[model samples]
Target: MRLSVVDTELCVGCQCCMFACARRSGLGGIASSAITVRSMGGMEKGFKVIVCRACDDPPCARACPTGALTPKPGGGVRLNASKCIGCGRCAQACVLGAVQWDDDVNKPSICIQCGYCVSFCPHGVLAMEDK
Candidate 1:
């Protein structure tokens, strides 16, 4: 499965999806979320929803020096935190800026495509579909 942005125009910058993503990991705030919602300059310009696009050939995985990131079956990558050296190369490699940083663990927080956040998006901005 993959999490898709159905319509960015429907997004209201509510950040409900981000909260839900973080909550899936038993976190209390957006800092741990794999998804992010940010203003496009200001509220009038709408918002940008940043999440892994599940690239067929992910550059982030290729940028990992320690082999901590391996490509997932469908797309994206699976992170092995124990092998991660906190190099932050993965974040820099993501062209979409989808790879989120976890300051607490000093690791990347990647979307597993579990679709936990889709249900929380009140504006129908997100969806889960088969790859």
Candidate 2:
């Protein structure tokens, strides 16, 4: 699949992408989204959109000791919390900084390629395409 994002130079530095990404968890709050946008300085320089690049060979999956970060046959990695050991190896292995650490739950927060966050983005910053 060809995954891409719609980067607009006209971003308003509003962290709607962050809140949108957090909404992908199906929770009422914004804790599960993989994307985040933060102010550069005082919102004058604008915000930075941070999210997973959906790598071809995800290094995070290789660092999981419990097989919690297994790659799906279709694409992307499938995180199994039951098999997770809470080790930060996956986080360290991820060069793109996509694998996040959930300190509250003591687990790694990984993106499963679910496109829920794309809908919440008013700026159209994220998308999942089929190759």
Best by lDDT: 1
* Whole-model alpha-carbon lDDT for candidate 1: 0.91
Per residue, candidate 1 scores C-alpha lDDT tens digits across 1-131 of 88889889999999999899889878698778999999899989988998898988899999999999999988989999899999999999998899999898889998899998999999899999888
lDDT of 2 by residue, 1-131 (tens): 53456674556766676676566665655565566666667777776665666665678887788888887676567789888888899889876566767766788777666676667667766666873
Q: Give TM per candidate.
A: 0.96, 0.80
Give residue 95's lDDT in candidate 2 (0 to 100).
69
RMSD (Å) of each candidate, 1 decimal: 0.9, 2.4
Which sections of candidate 1 miss by over 4 Å?
Answer: none
